[model samples]
Target: MNSSTHLDLAFTALADPTRRAILARLSEGEATVAELARPFSISQPAVSRHLKILEQAGLITTAVDAQRRPRRLEAQGLAELSGWIERLRESWGYNFRRLDQLLAETAPALEPERTGS
Candidate 1:
């Protein structure tokens, strides 16, 4: 998929608090569905649904370990998102700098007012 397409999926998957929480947990280490489901009161199926969405978005991926399918954070997906955000921040910073320069040029210098003693 294209970058925009991946970003769209990632943002949509991240919109849910539960999914975000899941990602946070996976950030620490890979976990089985049961391990991930323990923090929330939700059912295993519900957690699996969230996991499916996350996997679809490329934010997480599964690995086979014996009979367990553990999920872990995908660095490429996170890095893509981070890079996009950093580009935005850099653009905004440049615009702010330009604005400051313009304001400095147009604004009059402040002079101290003397009070009669």
Candidate 2:
């Protein structure tokens, strides 16, 4: 999928607190659905639904191991999201610098009005 689609999926998945918690758990290590469900009050099936969304967003992956399927975090989706955020941060940084410069330039003119000049 393209970058925008991938980002959309990642953000949508991340919009849920439970899904974010799931990702946080996976970041520490891979886990089964049961392990993932233990921290929350929700049922295992509900946790599984969250897992499905995360997997679809490309934020995680599952591995088959006998009777269990363990899920782990996938870096590619997160990397894309981080990169997009970095770009936005840089743009905002530039804008802030320009704003500071503008205020500095206008400061002297405003001083006279403050003195009732």
Per-model lDDT: 0.96, 0.94
User: In model 1, where do residues sit more than 4 Å from their true spots?
Assistant: 109-117
For 5-78, candidate 2 gives per-residue lDDT tens digits of 99899999999999999999998999999999999999999999999999999999999999999999988878
The numbered model that scores best in TM-score is 1
The sequence of per-residue lDDT tens digits that candidate 1 reaches over residues 1-100 is 9999999999999999999999999989999999999999999999999999999999999999999999999999999999999999999999999999
- Which regions in candidate 2 have their CA more than 4 angstroms from the true location? 113-117
With candidate 1 superimposed using the best TM-score fit, by how many Å does residue 62's alpha carbon deviate from the native? 0.2
TM-scores for the candidates = 0.91, 0.91
Minimum summed lDDT over a 10-residue window in model 2 is located at 108-117
Clashing pairs in 2: none
Alpha carbon deviation, residue 90, candidate 2 (Å): 0.7
Q: Candidate 1 has what TM-score?
A: 0.91
- Which pairs clash in model 1? none
